[model samples]
Each structure stands twice: as C-alpha cells, then as structure tokens.
Target: MKIKICFLLLLFAFSNSFGQQNNFNYKREIIGTNDQWHKLELPNEIFGKISPNLNDIRIIGISEQNDTLEAPYIIHSTEDQIKNVNVDFKLLNQSRDKNGYYFTFKVPTSNSINQIQLNFEQENFDWKTTLEGSQDQQNWYTLVEDYRILSINNAHTNYQFSKLNFPNANYGFYRIGIKSGEKPKLESAALFLKEIVKGKSRNYQIKKINTIENKKRKQTELDIDLGSPVLINNLKVNILESFDYYRPVHIQYVTDSTKTELGWKYNYQTLASGTLNSIEKNEFKFSNTVAQHVKIIIKNSDNEALTISNVEIGGSVYELLVRFSKPAKYFLYYGNTNARRPNYDISRFSDNIPKSITTLALGDEKIITKSETPKSEPLFADEKWLWAVMALIILILGGFTLKMIKKTDEREV
Candidate 1:
C-alpha cells in the first residue's frame, strides 16, 4: 500500500511536468522552402504574446516520417552597426586669434576622414566651429561651417555634443576654428572614419499623448500610449521652439498594471536617460523593450518649458536564424509560461551562420486546442478518472488509520 501511494504521487508530478513541457498556446506555420537554414522575422503581433525575454519561442519541425524535432535558433535584432577607423595625427599648432581659438592637425597618412571628436576641460560652454582642410596650410577649403558644439555640466545634467561630422575629405592638414569669447581649454581630439550601417526598423504609432506641467517640481511630463505592446528601442522628441535650450530627459515604460477603485495603476521601469539639447537630433536608443505605455519626464529647472511638436518611437525588427537538419515542415510556437531558455551549439558558434539566407514568412496564427488527444492515452484520461484515483488513495489511507486506532483500543482494553 505504501509503495502504491508513493508511485501515484510520482506519476502525478510526472504528468504535470510533461504537460508543461509540451503545452504551447499558439503556433504559426513557416511559409518557405525547406532550405538548410532560414531566417524568420518576428511580426509585431508576437510581442504581446511571448515572454519579454523571448525564452518561450520555439521552432518545431515535422519530418516526412511524422517525427517532431526542435530546431535551435538565434534571435537577431536589426540594430545600427558602426565601424570606426582612427587616423593617426599630430597637433601642429594651437593659437588664439581675434576670431577665437584655432588648432591645426597634420595627418601623416592623409587618410580620408569624416569625423573629428573633441574633448575639453571646460564643463559649460557653447561654441560654433568651422573646419577647413588643405594639403598645404596656406590653401584651405572649408569642410564644415558654423557647426554648433555644446556641453552642459550641472547638478541635473551632464551632456556634450562636440563631435564634428562632415563629408569624407583627404588632406594633409586640418584646421578647426572655435568662436568663443575666451580661449577654450583644449584636452584631446580624435580624427576617424565612421561607417554606419543602418538597420531595418519599424515605427510605432502613438495612440494617445498627454502632457502635464508641474511648476512645483519644475518638470514637464508626457504620457504616451502605443495601442498594443510592441518592442521599442528608439525615441525622438521633437521640440517646436527654435530657441536654444537644454533639458535632462528621463524615459520609462510600463512593466505591469493593476486596477483599483481609483483607476488603473501602472508600474514603470527606466528605459533610458539622456539630455535633450537643441544642437543634436534629440534621438535616444536603448535595448529592445516591450511596452505599451511610455512616459517622458523633462527636468526644466528654472528654464521655461519648451513646446513639444511630436514624438517618434520605433524599434529594430527581430529575426530568428534557424537551422533545419532535413526537409521538413516547421511551425513557430510560443506563449508558454513555463518554458525555459534553450541552450544550443549554434548559440556558442554564431560565426558559422551564413552571411545571407532566405527570409521565411509566417502563416496565419492558430491557437493550440486543448481538447486534442495525444497518441497514447493515460490512466487518468478524464477529469472523473483523476478524481476517482484521488478518492481511492484517500480511502486506503483512511482504512489504515482506522485499523491502527482499533488495534490501539483493543490493546488498551
């Protein structure tokens, strides 16, 4: 009897584990050729259904023999790829003129350079700059004119935009003119060729926007709602005013929500924080985040609030690089709460991935029906059978307890 009870308990636990492992809420067929490797871009609809970490996603392939196999995949996000090549240069001279300050750099290789990054010791300064390039110091051609470089260092914000970007120009010597009242303290400078590979992205529509100004806190808050939860990583806050202004901006997204008698309460987590200035584009990027509601808080301090024209939010599209062993029909399954992150060899050796592969499309999503029966039926196939098993176990335990009590009563008498 003891062995039977222990066996029943173990069976119950095993059944639960089996169900959790195989149960997935939704699936979509992969509409592509049975290539050795394929890439599938995840649609926006899956963002709301899958886990935030995306551990629940799986690719199941059915072979011609009707055997199911799990395929390993790597999630790839289309984020901007940047490559920079530093050009060795020497500072030929630094002088102050009636205009302001000027610095000359001589490049030995005379490589084609597009960007110059400057570092300064002074914390707070706004300066306009002009860049000129020439093979000889005497003959100079203007590269960038009247470009603004700004830095604001205070208790509330630390921001700088001192990088000068221009078209690729090859010259033996380069001179920079800074327009400032006093001699600007120069720290360091770097000349490099920057190559940016823009990634594929999708912009999300903002369903609603609400603004609130808090005079007491000296802050302006904007509440933005994207109708449904989607993956986002980029935001652009457009300011309408042309006047120069700088403010520290805090970005957050709703993680969870609760409903109460008052209203719906939202819990938010920080996504990114940066300074918003008139000199730069005011665009911010962070890790891909799944959110439906976002909040932006701007620290105005004593400065007047700037008018917001509009806000743009977007994220890089996610793709799955999957390897298929044999020609098989595959289906993408997700929405399993108890799923664990899979470890595969391809994840460790990502360099083996092909440079180019066919991108597969997804078919219409279908919900997995719970009423579908498995190939092999269990002892407790129905709810009534499970209840009956539980009742039998209880009766056997009760009988043993009564027997023990009766034996003890007889001995006492």
Candidate 2:
C-alpha cells in the first residue's frame, strides 16, 4: 500500500510540472477604473518577449469576491482606411499625330475622378504625358502637364510607374496625350477616385547600418539593426544618386542564428520585395512583422551601385480593444509558447463596438515565476522495508532446504 501511494505521488508531481510549463512568464497591471470597454496600446518592449502572433496575451481580472475573470480582446493595427470608387468612361477617340499619340475618354455622368492608371503592352518605354479635362471637347483645360511615365523590362528588373494622380476634377471629357515618336500600344486604363484616411504610426530608430558591395555577385547588401525587435510594416530607402536607375531589391529579416566555427550564422526570411526605382518613391509596405535585424539586397547587375542616403522604418501602432464586465483589477499576461490563439464572440461583433473608448495605461512589468511542486518521498528511504523483504526471502529458502533433506532421508531408509 505504501509503495502504491508513492507511485501515485510521483505521477502527480510530473503532471503538475507539465502544467506549470505552459503558464505565462510575465504580466503587467492594467491601470484604470471600471468601464464597459477600454483600449490599451502595446508597448514596443514586449514585442520581443511575446509570441509573434500574440496568441498568448491574456487579460485577467480579479474581482472583489476573489473571482478570476478573463477579458476578451481584439488586436487592432492602425492603418490607412482607403475607399475607392470606379468611374465609368467610354473611349471617345484614339488618334496619332506627328508629335505623339492621343486618347480621349467621355464620362457619361460627369463624375469627379482624381486618378488614372494606364497599362501598356510595350516591354520598355520612357515617355511624358499631359492630361486635359473639359466639358466641351473643343475647349480643353489642362489639369496635368509634363508628367513622366516609365517602364523598364530587362534581365535584371521589371518595373513600371504609369499612374497619374491629380486634384479631383469633374468634366464630361478627358484626354491623355503621350509624347512619343512612334505609336504607343495602350492596353487599358482605369479612372477612379481614391479616398484615403491615414492612421497613426510610430517610427523605430535604426541603431546601425552596414553596407557591403559584393562585386562577384553584382549586388549591394545592407545590414540594418533596429537595436531591439519591433513590429514594422513600412520601409523607405532614400537613394543619393540623381541619374535614373531601376533595380530589383529584396528585404529580409533574421529569424534565427547558430554559432559556427568562425562566427554566428544567421537564417533569414524574405519580408518584402520590389523594384527600387528613381521614378517613384522608394517606399515598400507589407504585412506587420516582428524583427530586429533586417537585410536589403539590391541587384545592380553590371551598373554602378547606387548610394543609399537614409533608411526609414515604421509601422502602425497595435492596440487592444478589451471589454470589461464590472469594476475589477486587471492584469495582462503573456509569454507562453504553448498557448494557442483565442477565439471570442467579440471578434465577430467588432462592428458593434463603440467608436470612442477610454485608453488605459499599463503598469510596470512583473515576472511571473512558476510555483514549485512538492517533492515526493523516495520509495526505498525506510531501512525497515528493506530488512523485511530480505528476511522473507531467507525464510522461503530455508523451507526449501529442509524439505529436500527430509526427502533424501526417507529414500535411504
């Protein structure tokens, strides 16, 4: 019975240890009074410690009755709100003059539009364009003048910048003129009004940048360190060269590293990729990623390497929209690898949430140490049990020896 009890205790100890392994490692107090809902902006310091998907984040509240309650939350990333409206237009005329080519379009409802995207079948071209709007085709008013449209298609880079943006203009007729020696093959065009509502963002300071030119590979590589891991989505590369150039660039981040004989070898994953061109703003936006070390590779091919003047990295702020039931003290816990992402009804009904919410501040971070489990006593610790087992074995051997002696004596008689 004692041995059985000891075995059960050992099993219980192992189960408790496994449970504690999944417990949160860190927590912070949510400092605010009772409210229906509250917003909390996540601090940058916690990005490195928490899970990349933020699945382990939990808002736990303790009530006056000593009851623990979990508050459901939704992670929100502040980003641009864009609304686009496509305007219907019919091609009125397409003609070519000695200087260039012209295409005219007529809007039926005379809706206002501020942007036009032009697509072409040509592999490469560099041309200037002029846009004019008018209610009567005979009398045209110039809206945009001497705008450049560029496209480059080669072994190294494939890029195009053919979008025309201007102030909203309402007209019955719109005309586009391309300054080209030969006829231009126009594939399609789109006219639309784009409304964008920019959101708040925070810029991360880059601590150091190291540039290296790989002459053998014909590439320029930049190693960037942001001091600490941060959630970033946007990056801008400023070039110092004045001449026109287009190059394919790839952005990557370090995911892990290993120690080799010479130094630490890093494994990187691509975050974003696009063409770095002089015609457009060299800005690239991608999904939010948590990273500390980033690498940029520019394919220069046979051309001279372009000088980089500055690099800017930033992202939208992450906020938690939490709903509270009653007045209670709440704490945020995170840093658990075993935790899965939570699903709550509030996520489905996010539209019902109030537009305005009171933001709450967070207290100092505290480390949550796991509770120690009780140690079970050893099964063979008592000397009495060892002696008892030894005496029982001796008694069985002695009985067998006496029975064999009696059998031998009976056979001799």
Candidate 3:
C-alpha cells in the first residue's frame, strides 16, 4: 500500500509539470497612399479625415456596401465636385440582397483618360464591369477594353485593365458601371490612377519594399530606384542539391576573420534565388576546426567589414566542409552494404558527447568509446514501463506472502 501510494504521487507530480501556460500579445502597422496602400499592418485603426484641395480620392479593401472602412486609413475629397474616382475592393458580403461601396470623385473635364489597377486573388466566379465617363452622372460609355489576370503565387492573383482614355480632353470623371452579377468572396484589392502632365519627370522612386509570397500567381512587386544599386560584396555558397526534395538540417561554416555570411537563398530549382547579407559588427574567418555548433548570423548592413567561417553540410553520414559561421560539430553517415539488419541506424542516433571528440592515441579506446557505452535509447529501452510494472508486481506478491505467513502463525497461537 505504501509503495502504491508513493507511485501515485510520482505520477501526479510528473503530470502537473508536463502541461504549459499561455502569455502572448499581438500588434500591426500599415503605410501607403490612398490608391496604392502598402505595408498593411494587422488590427487596422480606421481614420475619418480628408484633404481640402482634393484632386482625387480612392478607397481600398472594404467588405460591406456602405462606407464602413475598417482599414487603416480613410480617403475623402473636400471639393464640391469630384472628378476621377476609383475603388478597388473585394465583395465580402455576397448574395443579391447587398451592394459593395460607391467611390465618388470630381474631375475638371469630361471624356479624359483614366487607368485602374486592382490587386486581388481570384474567386470561383469572374467579376466584370464597364468603364463609364460622365459629367452629369446620367449617360455612360463602355470605355474599358477587357480584363487581364496576373499571378503572384499559388495563393494570390491580380487583375488589371484600362478604364477609359479621352483623346480630346485633359481630364475627366470616371466610374465603373456595376452590372448585376455574382460577387466573389472578397479578398484584398487596391486601386490605381494616372494624371496628365506635359513635362513632368516619371522618375519616381520606391523607398521600401516587402514581399507577401514567393509564387508566380500573385508574386509581390516592389518598385525601387533612388540611385545606383547598393554594392553588397558577398561570397556566394550554393547547395547544388535542391532544398525542396531534401533539406540538410545541419550546416556549419568557418569564419575566423576573412569571410562574411550572406544568409541563405532558398531555391526550388535552378539559380534564381534571393540573397541575405552580413549585418553590423560581424566578422568571419577560417580557422582550426574542433568545435561543435553552427550559427548563421545576419550582420547589420551598416558594417564596413565582416567575416564568415566554415560551411559544412550534413544529411546523414555526409558532413562536407564548406564554410563556417562559428565553431561547430557536424556528422553525416549512410549505409554501405546488405548485411544483417544494421545495428547502428544513423538516423536514430545522437550522442550527448560527439564521437569525433574522442580520438584514440594509438589503438586504445578512449573512456568515451561507443562500443563500451551502449547507445542512449537502447540502454534503457529494455527496462522501460514493462520492467517497472513487473518489479511492482513482484514486490506486492512478496508482501502478500509475508502477510499470509503472519496470519497462519497468529491462528495457531
């Protein structure tokens, strides 16, 4: 009884310590123009103000028919009469009972050229609209030619089309004639516009760029051109083997003082890939190789000089020296022949102290020899829960036998 009581207590203690608790928080930030919203941070805080001398105003990403824009920013025009207006939004509310949003703008003239760019993912059904140029808001023209699809990745898509172009006028008011049709389950969408000027320079530049996905369906596009491309001197390391098919979890490189790590550029195939460069105050060098850990550090970009170390790759028994990040231990192994079921399955083995650390002076097995110290799992496998249950049963049987003998003695007395 005492032994069982102690066993129950031990189990209870282990169970209590096994589970985990939660402590987490979240935040987001967004920045961009009215039509070209970029860097959308999550948990968007909506705004409700407009510029006074408004030439145009475009709103993006709304769900309902009304102007309930829960996005990060709000857009409105101050002028009594608005001209060119464009709204790129996904139809979040479906069915014929509801409408999307109405985009309003005032233009100086009628029958002017207008362009619309909408970024969105495709739905099961296709969405079509007619481009209409109007001054009195009654008669409309089908100016838009057709729709074209742009793929970013497997997950997203973009649609683009020319709205209307006026050969005579310098500016005009335009709106998309919403025909009665089935709306797509709304995804992310944005608007685009073009203004007419005689001698303005088209050399506008992008300050920052970020990618959402890495596929072809809706590949992220960033426009950047300030000056010449910044020169980031680098030593390129290519894993000839494709990562999609097989990934090497263990890679070590040596950088004492000469080399710098430009981080990994993952490729599904061929040479097309991205690049990660050294960050600040980091150096790399090649040196005496006796350590057992590898780290890939992205040095801050503001540094003058940085070094990278040995690069080693491991799959199984396949550790090959290439470069270094720091002191590291690497091991790889593979099968050789068709012998009796192999005793050492490299896949299932990891030594607390790496076997390479222990070397024989002549022919003497070191104190840390693998043959003497059995592999970790095997040493304790045979005597797991089964053996513990067996020991408990034996102890209980012995105690019962002792009790029976004491009872017999008492009855005789």
Candidate 4:
C-alpha cells in the first residue's frame, strides 16, 4: 500500500508539473468521520482540468487501474473495520385514537423525559394535541398545548413521525392528548433517551446561510439564500418584542416551475405556530430535506416588525465513511470545475452481502462525533507557492512580449 501511495503521488505530481497554466491543484479536506470506508465522489471539476482526452482519470485510495499508475486517493495501507452502535428505543404507550385519545403517563421525580415517540397506523387525517404536567392528577398544568402530530401517506407526501421532544420538566404525572382524530391505530412506538459513548472526532458542519430581513407592511418576510443545496434541519426566529404569541410561519423553497395556468406555482410547507409565552427564543425545526433557497413569510398577527430582530438557520451534520489502517495524513479535496461525479455505493459490503436484504431494524440514530467544516485549511491542496511561481513566469513572458512589440513599432517609425 505504501508503494501504491508513493506511485500515485508521483503520478499526480507529474501531471501537475505539466498541467495547463491554471494547473490542477489538490488540497486537503475534512468531509466526514465515519467508521466504515466511505466511498466518496470526487469533485467533478478535477476530471476536466487534469489530463483531458484520456479515456479515464485516476483517484488515489480509490482506483487501482494499472500497476504503473496508481490512483491518487489510495491510502497508506489501513485496516478496515465498522463501528456498530447499539440503538434501541422503548415502548411508551399504545392505544387507539378514537375521538381524541388522552392518557396520563407517570414520570419519576428524579428522571426527566425529553422525547415522546408515536407510531401511527391510520393513513388519512391529521391529529393535533398537547401535553400537560402536574404533581397530582387532579390539578394539571399545560406543558405544551395545541401541538400537532401528522402522519401522511400519499403520492405527494409520505411521512411517519414517532418522536416529539420538549424541554425536560420535573413532573410526577404527564398527560398525552390526541385531537381531531377517531380510531387511529397505534402501529408501534418507543420513547428513548439516547445514550452512547463519545468518539474522538468532531462534528461535520456544511452550511452557508445568507439572511435578509424585509419589513413588510403587515408581516415580516425573509428571503434566505443557502449558498447551495443543503439538508436543513431547523431555524431559530428571533423576536425582540416581550409579548409572546403564536403565529404560523410559512416556508417555501424555490421550485423549478416555468408557469402554471393560475400563475407561478409555489410548493409551500408550513409549521403550526407554537405557544411562545416568554421573551426568550422560539425555534422552528424541520425534518431532514434538501433545500437551496427558502422564503419565510412570518404572520405578523398585528405584531409590528420592530419586534423582529434576526433569524438563525442551521443545517444538519453529514457523515461519510472512511477506512484507515492507522493514523495517516489525509486530505479532503473538492471543487473540480469540470468533472463527472463518480458513482459508488458505500452501504454495500462485498463480503457481507445479505441474501434477503428486505428487512432492516435500525437502532437509535444520533450525531456521530466527528470534526465539522474541517480544520483551518485551504479549499484545495496548499498551492499558494505555485501561484507565486506562476506569477514570476508570467512577468517574464509579459516583458518578452513588450520587447517584441517595441521592435515592431520602431521599425514602422
């Protein structure tokens, strides 16, 4: 493996030396930290810049084309292993939702409940409810009221949600209510608090949010540009006013549509307004979905624009698989101006190919500990020195061109 890495490095160096004036520069990147070997797609731009006209290009650690020409992506010999996380959730309560199901659950005085899981079997209809906590069952106080639980299974939309989280409260008894539904079967559900051993890696953060506040006449609108398509998880809307109220926040992504009969069509999704009774922050969290541009229409409800301050949008952390034998120097490279994104499946293992792979029981899902954004490094392999050399060469060439042009002009005179 050492021999292969050295050979690939030499080949890449050779290509770089003879590359175009712009040159093909490789750089270090920190994309993800996963236990399995993540087969990644090289930045398409790399393919166009390198030895063009060739039938194929080589990536180290990836391709083993020829014994003489090794791939640039190959690692320095590493053992491959997988990290199995034992993830299992517990069942809370399973009952039919006929004419709105409401039940009282028990919570110990010591332990705090953070997550509420639900599994629905019925296909049609939307259910909304809330939770109330109290020391005694007779005297109850609303914890989170008018909360919605939707289970949609249709051609356009298909969703099965079983988890609802809230700020942990120390309460002896908790009430669960299901509103606006009759005879909704309980498929299977579990309430679990994730507990796992921490790994020695950082989280991967890949998002760039550009926020613009537009104070409308009776409402607040924001046209947010997320630099690129990202799987956004949530956004926090900052309301500066002291008064707390619930107003629906509508979100719509820039859909690819020329024009419809009624006019330009927009695919809009909405989050029901939550009860905001404090001066603190109120958050709107969405499921994992890819969106490049987002437009937010904040319902003012007579709430002035002066009350709004700012909004914060955050994307979900992405994980990639990498198989390393030992601690070796690795780099994350991307931004191939012109190249085809390679195709490879990371989930499939050559050895353990399940014959009947229809069923899969996944455990609790949590953020795998890994580095985010990447350590302070340039986008490409460190190539600032190459720029200096190119500048000097360009200066010499420019001077030579000037001398020739002067001779021609002097002859004409």
Most accurate candidate by lDDT: 1
lDDT of 4: 0.48
Q: 1-413 in candidate 3: lDDT tens per residue?
A: 66557666866664332211000011111122222222221110111111112111111122223221222222111112224444332332222433422233345533234455433344333344445455555665545523322222222222132233323322244554333343333243333344433311112122332223324332222222222221111123332322111111112322222333875433221111222221111122232122112333222222222222222221101011111112212111111122122222322433322323211111211122222111122333343553575577668767876897899899999
Question: What tens-digit string does per-residue lDDT give for candidate 2 at 1-413?
Answer: 44446545865674555464338888888997568988999999999999898998988876776655778999999977779999999988899887689999999995799999999999799999999999989999999989999888877677889999999999999999999987789899999999889987999889999999999999999999999999999999999999998899999999999999999999999999998988889999988999999999999999999999999999888999999987777888888877889999999999999999999999999886554111111332344554575567557656766787889899999
- From the highest TM-score down, the ranking of the candidates is 1, 2, 4, 3
Evaluate model 2: give its TM-score.
0.84
Candidate 3 to truth, TM:
0.20
- Total backbone collisions for each predicted model: 0, 0, 66, 28
Score each candidate by Cα lDDT: 0.87, 0.87, 0.28, 0.48
Candidate with best TM-score: 1
lDDT of 2: 0.87
Window of ten residues with lowest summed lDDT in model 1:
372-381
lDDT of 4 by residue, 1-413 (tens): 44446555865674454342122244433333232234433332333233322223322222122112111222111112233322243334534455477655665534556666777667765667677777777899877876666555655334444456677556677777777537656665444444334322211232444444455545556667665554455666677666534454566666444578889865645532432323224666555445556777765555654355666665433322334333223344333345443444423454443222221112221221222221222332345654665567557666766787889899999
Off by over 4 Å in 4: 1-217, 224-232, 252-281, 287-294, 301-303, 324-333, 336-346, 350-413
Instruction: Choose 2 or 4, whichever is better by TM-score.
Output: 2
Tell me how candidate 3 scores on lDDT.
Answer: 0.28
Q: Write the per-residue lDDT of candidate 1 for residues 1-413, one digit (tens) a residue.
A: 66457757876895674476457888888988567888999999989998899999988866667665778999999978889999999999999878989999999995799999999999999899999999978999999999999888877778889999999999999999999997888899999999889999999989999999999999999999999999999999999989888798999999999999999999989999988888889999899999999999999999999999999999989999999887777789898777888899899989999999999889999987654222123443355665676678768867777897899899999
